[model samples]
Target: MTECDINNQTISRPGNSWLAAAVWNNSYTYKVSAHCPLHYCLPYSTHLNFSIPNSQCQFKRAGILCGHCQQGLSTIFGSSNCQKCLNIYLFLIVPIAISGIILVLLLFILNLTVTDGTINAFILYVNIISINTPVFFPQLGKFTPAYTFISLVNLDLCIQTCVYNRDDYAKMWLQLAFPFNLIFIATSLIITSRYSTTIQRLTARRALPVLATLFLLSYTKILLIVSSVLFFYSKIFHLPGDHTELVWSVDANVPLFGVKFITLLIACFIIFLILVPFNIILLFTRWLSRFTLINKFKPLIDAYQGPYKDKMYYWVGLQLVLRVVLFAVSSLDRNNNVIIGIVLFILVIGLHGTTLRPFKNEIKNYQEKIFIMNILILFALALYNHGTTNMTAVNVMIGLAMGHFILIVIYHIFTYALSGVTRNKLQLHINTLVGWIIRLLNKNPVHQSRLDSHVMNKIPTAVNYHEYREPLVVQD
Candidate 1:
């Protein structure tokens, strides 16, 4: 058939008959059309008017639906009903769950495998290096190479192992270690300064030497963090083995590993840094024997008033001094750090509780505020201990800390909410009384109109209502 006739005319043929038209050209141009109404091919008359071409003209057989529909059908029939469980399945719950699992696994690996050799070496070197004095300050001595290794390469390794292998716990610790250490340093510095200055002025002696030594100890805390990170990476991921492992114990149940040993060593170095100066002070100064609680308070109260600020600053200063001393004593005997830590635990709680007392009337509001402040403090402390602590142990510590913080947070929220309700009620009563007064003063239209005009024209007075006047009383 001709192409022109095929395009214009509609014709019916047998069920499987095909139609082809060749155009008038040197080369034959064939066009094939099919009609298969049983399988709804090209088209059959339904709501729309179109013809279904015979299947015989088709190159390949056509199905009712595409491959996608087939697969969908198979899934529907073979798999469980996705729609029925879509609320849980379609949401981000699965992705979050999977990510959480992966994060936990990484933390597990980091906690179980990372070592602490580099940290111990650094601690030893810092103590040894600082022992020689100011000439070795910026210069690289024998200890300088290890210090260089930590700054240049160990940092990256710590970050990698902590972040990728240990992830959640590592990141958490890294974030917290810096701020906490800073707090400790600042607190220690303040106490040391106060102690030295007080001793010099009161006793007619120079305590600068001892104070300077105390200053040296603050830096060791930072070194400890750095060393821990380095040691973890060097031993955990880069060790000579196919499988890497982290092996620090966070709980009483678990045995301590090299990392823990390093951590303890770092703690010891910090003690030495603190004690060496105090010992020097003790040797020269008979005032050390006479050092009493009253002397501490005299310096403290002389500094501030208002119980809250006084106690806070005093407690912080005291804690710093005590921590340094405790750390020193503990170095001589580790059981001592634990005993001191227990004492500190009690003192911290007492001081923290005292802070809450000032806001007892507004407990809820106060608690919320306190919680936020504590969170910041906790964050700082955590940063200082990051790679230095075991991942699993660190995580548990953080979780418990957060729970402790959250309890206080919830308490404060309710307190504020109650205060708000009380304030609203008081305001409502004031509004009602004002409305009643306005209604009671029902003057004539002219008087009322004049009063309104006068009110708008004049400047407002200190006294709101001019209608009521009272005799003034004067006192000699």
Candidate 2:
């Protein structure tokens, strides 16, 4: 709870996990770089200089950061006046958790059911160019390929025609993969860095959900990598079964099995490369924080602290090392998939970002960022499929997904830009604007006046009035 002066003088506090940020002036405004809990420990190389919190309640109020509060508040009010805190979990987090589970399940089910030719085509979805002709694609007439889809009313699955069954559409998806993955990776790295910073500042009580989300993402990616490797590596097994027409099975003994294997290995490697160095730096920083005082490193650390060049070198170098390691390890996949497993672990680590935060801010954690990213990425994929194919089902999905994507993107981007001095004002404004959308989706829209009146009643006179706005709180 101690605040530093504007003079930049060192004011060290002992055994204080509560105050990680250095404040200038009495207002508790924080230095962005000094916001991580381990500000006293090691320097953060991957943290983003996004808007920092400016109030005491930010650090004190239920341990939620300004950003996450906005989201939770949306959920709270998304129902009716957000009558209880549980609504926050129900309205916001549950849907995302469910989506992630469904996504993982879909990946596995699709992998298991798709024909070997289809699996080969799926792997080729990232290839720069297509080699397969229409004949290679397993389709009935032209665009529609066959799959078993459940009929909602009958609760029965019947073989139906879908664009995903088309080999050409799969190839088209790969054409878009470069930009899609590029955007996804870039955005994911940024969010992961943000999550790292948030986790550091979070109290044990506040961090439970964030930690769980991180673990979930990690587990999901592990499953994805394992499933990916299994599907691709199966070419080597040459298992006797009903299916033996896989052209991918041609290279069973090669180091990575085939081009697709190399491609996936490289993809996983790239993610691991991003994760390793950042986490290493975090470990080093934490270890150093406990031993070194400001006075000891001030003179030396100050030299690199002002300019961004050397730091950039460290940052950029670490990123390049990811690429280097990926290619390096891909050359030697020895020891019974151990290397693959190790890389898979690294990919999961890399996909998740750095761990450090000054004010246990839930503003944007791994889950929110990853959830948004996946949705957007899916939009890009769905859009591509819709455009390339003539199937009615693909077009219908695209129609729905694109519309949802556009609405969510617009609503989120617009409201996220709105910040207020008081959590009440911020949440109220945010909840009022975004809450309706949430309700609409949940199919339980309350009258606007009712919600406003309810929210007004919940906020005491001292807390709600704009004239007596709450000061922003940033915790460490």
* Top of the candidates by lDDT: 1
Worst 10 residues of 1 by lDDT: 74-83
Q: Clashes per prediction?
A: 26, 18
Q: Assess each prediction's global lDDT (C-alpha) against the native.
A: 0.33, 0.31
Indicate the TM-score of model 2: 0.21
- For candidate 1, write residues 428-466 as lDDT tens digits: 989999988777664567778888898888966556564
Give lDDT tens digits, candidate 2, residues 191-215: 5655687533322122222222222
Assess the local accuracy of residue 358 in candidate 2 as a C-alpha lDDT between 0 and 100: 14
TM-score of 1: 0.22
TM-score list, all predictions: 0.22, 0.21
